[model samples]
Target: MADDTGNLELEAFRAEARAWLEANFPPALKGKGGLAMAEITFQDADLATWRRAIGEKGWATPTWPKEYGGGGLSRAQARVLQQEMGRIGAFNPLMFGMGVTMIGPTILDYGTEAQKQQHIPPIVRGEVQWCVGYSEPNAGSDLASLQMRCEDAGDHWQINGSKIWTSGAQYSDWCGALVRTDPTAKKHDGISFILIDMHQPAIETRPIKLIAGASPFCETFFTDATAPKDAILGELNRGWTVGKRLLQHERASQTGDRGPGGGGSAVALADLAKRYAGADAAGRIADPDLRTRVIRQQMDAKVHGLTLARAAAEAKEGASNAASVLKNSATHVAQTRAELMLEIMGHQGLGWDGEDFTREELEAVRGWLSGKAMSIYGGSFEIQNNIISKRILGLPDSTGST
Candidate 1:
């Protein structure tokens, strides 16, 4: 009886949320939200209006602090908002940038009062974009070995180094970068986390083309670029701690739990298989083995999602490296789905672009290619395994033993 009552309350809240969204959300922009920058059509007036409305409402950063222009929503309420948005095919007006998913959460965790007031509001409003600078040519998975240098320059800092695989670097307004501030200290101890403006002459970005023909990544160069002295986040020379926290947030973002953005919009694998591979009587997928695989994948995805919810429920303070577990699981689920998509579509999924294949088919091929990199980015699968081993499992260092 109590569970039934609680569910009734939730339904009432959902109805209210649905009504508000219908009245306020622009009709022309339905299903057009949550697009990556590369996928967005800039000329659409409706998109702009919707962005403003959602940003002003503070629902884009729903779980962030209300004082920082966030929605002040509980996790349950946030889920309701997501459900309501998905029901009407309403997309999140905020673009899929590092600001909301990665940087904003980290800043909220570590930023000073002034930094929070200055940065979080703009981010919550979707007024700016951010990129992370952690990886370098010599330091990808082993991030503590990074050599980007930031020197004291009185009122500001002079930064010089290059960062590789910086997603959306070419168009970012600011960067949350990890740099070496003390050469004499140990590799991990010498680092600092700082924010640097990207619109300066000393900063340059070159996009890296990928097999998918679309790229969100760039190689970013900093030739004595300037950052205000006050831009340091957390403590100086303790950025390894700060950087790890940021990565925890990042891995959380990549886990793809259906948040305010309603990220899981891809066609169901079973439905696709039925459409492409034909269906048996009673509307079941014809191939017994394929149907079993789909069921297994679906079960795994649900368990992964439930684990995420439990983790979210447990973490009142902040995320830990346990996010690494979710990151690996999400990578597996996403990559598996992409592979299954191709298998279902057969030759049709191989099409790139033309009238020859459906839009869904072309997207599947590209998605499969792009999904391959998920295990590599945000720290590789092997890196996550190391973390899970050393940190979570309390395993002794293998190198120390030999």
Candidate 2:
């Protein structure tokens, strides 16, 4: 049942959104979405056109504030826009960046007015790429142990040390990094979150090749890489709190609750199984066990979606730490799909590159390899469970215990 005026206005908005998408989004990219991180060829005319169109329209960050070049839509309106885009198979080109997923949100939460004016517009425009510099060679999972020094240098802060597993560091224009600012303070207390330009001479990036065909990960070194004195995000030596918030944003992005489709694939799982593994006499999947697993995964994905929607409805502003729950669920669903896709594709999935395997199959294998890291990234599965146990479950902390 639909109300007269409100329903009509919503319908009108949807129609307008659909028309804009149809006019602007390239036909080739409709179902394909934005280029996958590894496959991003920024020079492609179609991609460039689509990215520019959405960025300028401010639809790239639909729920963000308009002053920062965001779409200025309410949460409901943003959801509608996403639905309209999804209806047409259109994908947001700018959603892939750390800027969109992590940095920008943190900036909005804690940045000074001047900082927002300087950074948010470019981010909203998709004009820059950002990498997170959180993991150091020594820090890794124990991020608070980071030793990247940021020294006071009057006009700028001199940074020194290295970050490992920095995704997109080589291609990034900027980095939102966690650095140690005060050695005398507590491990988590003395840290600061800073924004550093990646194009400077003091910063260097080396790509780290993975077992997967493409490498988005990098080793980023800072030898006196400087951030402007005012570039420290949040209060000086209070980055641990800021960093945690950023992680929440990161987890939220991974859970797919914020944007279109909850990051789920357009192609249904059963369809893939039927296509690759073939069907039985009754037109059901031939493999009984695989069919069961696929059904369960589908159900789990649905449950995860419902839970996310519920969480969204409950939270008036910021999300709860329960994003960690969704993150773990998403990891499970994705890894399960990868495993099933490989099984269904069988030998076709094994080839890295050849005439024998379809592009989709090759991608599946690579995606499987890449998806394996999802558990490790955005806080590992174990870490998320720990969060769930303590934060969500109210379990006792086992620190300094056997």
Candidate 3:
């Protein structure tokens, strides 16, 4: 049943990957994927170097077409790369950028040849960052009810409106935004997805501070943000389809398909429990009740990981109804991990700031706070349930709405 030649070749490739990763991955940044999640700017030499190395090697966007500067690894080869990186406690620093997760894949799907040539390479190279402008003040879950005006200005398009909860807008170089191009048309029909340049003065971003301290979420305003006439993604008024497709991509990223598991440099919950709460004679968590709950949470996390792997194996591309199911599952695993961690730390985890708390303790408090949004963003928990009922369960849409 085994392909000997193929197995031999794969093993050879694995060796090459291990060597390359050893040569390139910075030891100081090992298991630091949490830093990548929080990083909006590159200031550290090691971080910058790691980004450059991966970008040049095209491993940052591995499996994307090589013509666009991606590694163009086969799906199997990509998994091998992931395993190698995990072994070294190396993670893709580029995961912080929305360019790879939402925008780049959407562009590949909906963009023209010229658009791909111009945009995809820079994204793959980690030379640019992107944000999505979807949720307006009034259009949070009801995204179709957007009111941003995108006027055809002969030579270019002018965008005038605000997008709330625009994550990373303050740092993004570009934005893929939806705008009302035909006000007279129906709500969904009038919307067109456009690629906007964020460097212009017409665009302003105000970061929304969170309970966890500084965050990427921002309130973005466009007084008269301009884009090229050719900046429209897909057909002009058919952007709802493109927008929905991008949402699928966003869900996929949250499903744990990307990162190597070794990052975050985090202490295992059990280890933390033993250290902070004291270990029993049997080397188990001292408290019986807390020990049972921690074991349950870890089981749930493992089940979630396996389910993700199954969903990935079933289909490597396209939007599947499984996304809704797994998206919620991912939120559960992440949030539960944070909660269990906080509980394990007990009173010490409550520290917002002080010399009394360890760095991990302070971060755990923030992480727990920030993890609350996991249920809401990327289409909320309730939204995913509705999707599952309709798409996966063959239930009717009772809300009589999109």
Best-matching candidate per TM-score: 3
lDDT of 1 at 299: 90
Query: How many clashing pairs per prediction, in order?
Result: 0, 0, 0
- Measured on C-alpha atoms, candidate 1 has an lDDT of 0.85
* Candidate RMSDs in order: 2.3, 1.9, 1.9
- C-alpha lDDT of residue 28 in model 2: 77
Every candidate's lDDT: 0.85, 0.86, 0.88
Residue-level lDDT of model 3, residues 1-402, one tens digit each, is: 379887887889899999999998999988778877765654678888888999999998888999999998887788888999988789998876789999999999999999999999999888998999999999999999999999999899989999999999988999999899999999889889999989999999999999788767999999988999999999999999999999998998887677433366456888988988898999999999989988998899899989988887888555688889999998998888898898888899899988999988888898899889989999999999999998899999897877
Q: What is the TM-score of each predicted model, taking all chains together?
A: 0.93, 0.95, 0.96
Encode model 1's per-residue lDDT on 299-328: one tens digit a residue.
989988898888887877655776899999
User: Candidate 2's residue-wise lDDT over 242-330, tens digit each?
Assistant: 99999999998888665742223567778888998989999889899999998988898789889989988888766588789999998
Please list the residue runs of candidate 2 whose C-alpha ends up more than 4 Å from where it truly belongs after superposition.
Answer: 1-4, 34-36, 39-42, 261-265, 400-402
